[model samples]
Target: MTSRFTELVVDCHDPEGLADFWCRVLDFKVIDRGEGKVEIGSWVPTVEEVRARQMPPTLLFLQVPEGKTVRKNRLHLDVSPVDRSTQDEVTRLLGLGATTADVGQDPDASWVVMADPEGNEFCVLRTLAPQE
Candidate 1:
């Protein structure tokens, strides 16, 4: 038996705004939208079609009243560039409302730590090698 990772839920102050930021960052589209939540992921498989095949986990942004504290997150995401250089992708993410984040990482760290508009931390790693 195997388990699949289907969704990553993010708590945010503004679900719609966060969803917009991530859509641009991931080149993803909004798959489902509701009063206080939005789901973004690949556009190929409609939400209803997701069960038919394996797919990357979708991001679900849910509205929350409390703001993020300065404490380090228990969990964070690390992303790698698929086609562009890491620096370029970091710049693009910055232009899309992400900001540099300091999380006690060593100055020589290879990945760039960044935070979304709502202050959720994620990392941009070096471009990954092509799969064989």
Candidate 2:
């Protein structure tokens, strides 16, 4: 049998806060909440609905006692716009507490690097062209 990617767990100081920020960024909703953890994914009214649809992997935020100390993240997420321009999305994300990040990328790079409120690094890529 082949393996399928299911979820990505993020270690954060505040699961609720991180989940809230990510939900807004990804247009997702909270799927589950447990002690010190929160799971957010594509907005589905119920688990049954989620099961019925082919959904992307969910993000789980787990509360941790220690804060992030790494200057650069070993693994980061790259987001592409669905219905908006990359600049517009970057502005929107900045309004939501994401700060501009410089990761030694070239000045002409097509993607913008940003950091979330808790200093986790992520990138916003240029939107894909329409398929014929």
Candidate 3:
């Protein structure tokens, strides 16, 4: 049997806060919360959907003592706008607390680097459905 990608866990100081930020960014909703963990994803799937392996991977924010000490992220996510232009999405993210981060990309790079509230870097790519 082959394994399917499921979830991505992130270490942060405030799980709920980070989850909230990501939920707004990704248009996801909080699905679960525990002592120090907050799980967010697209709306919960039915059992059949889960069995069919059709669920998008969820993000679980875990609280950690030594949170985000690194200067840069070793692994980052790249997101594309679903219904809006990349520049509009970047503006929306900035309004939601994401800050522009410079990881020494060339001026003509196709992606924009931005950091979440906990300083995790992610890139915003072109819109998913390009205008015709």
Candidate 4:
């Protein structure tokens, strides 16, 4: 059996603000909201709680008192464009407030390093494999 990904949770100081930033970046929407917690998801709501609970759940941004740090990231996401060129997608993400991070990749490499608004690192790659 294979497991399906329900969501990716990010810990941050400002949950709502971070959720808004990611929603804009990924075209995701807020599915659930609670005190110091915000969930954003890519899929539309299904059940009553998901629909009426007033919280987003695609990706959750949890509020933490400490500032964000990148000493190490156990998990990171790599995004790619559907039809647009990689260069174009990188430019678009940059415009959306993502900043470049120097990860020591060759200049000619197809993937570009970027950090989210909360300083979490991710990548925008040149290619995406076909969906199963």
Best by lDDT: 3
Per-residue lDDT of 1-132 in model 4, one digit per residue for the tens? 333345678889889888888888778888889999999887765665554554433688899888756554668888887757777888888888899887666888779888888888888887454444
lDDT of 2 by residue, 9-81 (tens): 9999989999999999999999999999999988534555445664578899999899988888999999998
TM-score of 4: 0.77
Residue-by-residue lDDT tens digits, candidate 1, 1-132: 345578899988899999999988888999999999999988645555565666788999999888887667888889898978889889999999999999899999999999998888999998884645
Candidate 4 colliding pairs: 30-56, 31-55, 31-56, 32-55, 32-56, 33-55, 39-56, 40-58, 40-59, 41-58
lDDT computed for candidate 3: 0.89
Give per-model CA RMSD: 3.0, 3.2, 1.7, 5.6
Which segments of model 4 are wrong by more than 4 Å?
1-4, 45-57, 127-132
Best by TM-score: 3
Model 1's TM-score against the true structure: 0.86
The C-alpha TM-scores of every prediction are 0.86, 0.86, 0.90, 0.77
Query: By TM-score, how accurate is candidate 3?
Result: 0.90
Which residue segments of model 2 deviate by more than 4 Å? 43-55, 129-132
Better of 1 and 2 by lDDT: 2
lDDT of each: 0.87, 0.88, 0.89, 0.78
Please identify model 1 stretches exceeding 4 Å from their true place: 1-3, 43-53, 129-132
After the best TM-score superposition of candidate 2, give how far the Cα of residue 102 lies from its true spot, in angstroms: 1.1
Which prediction has more favorable TM-score, 2 or 3?
3
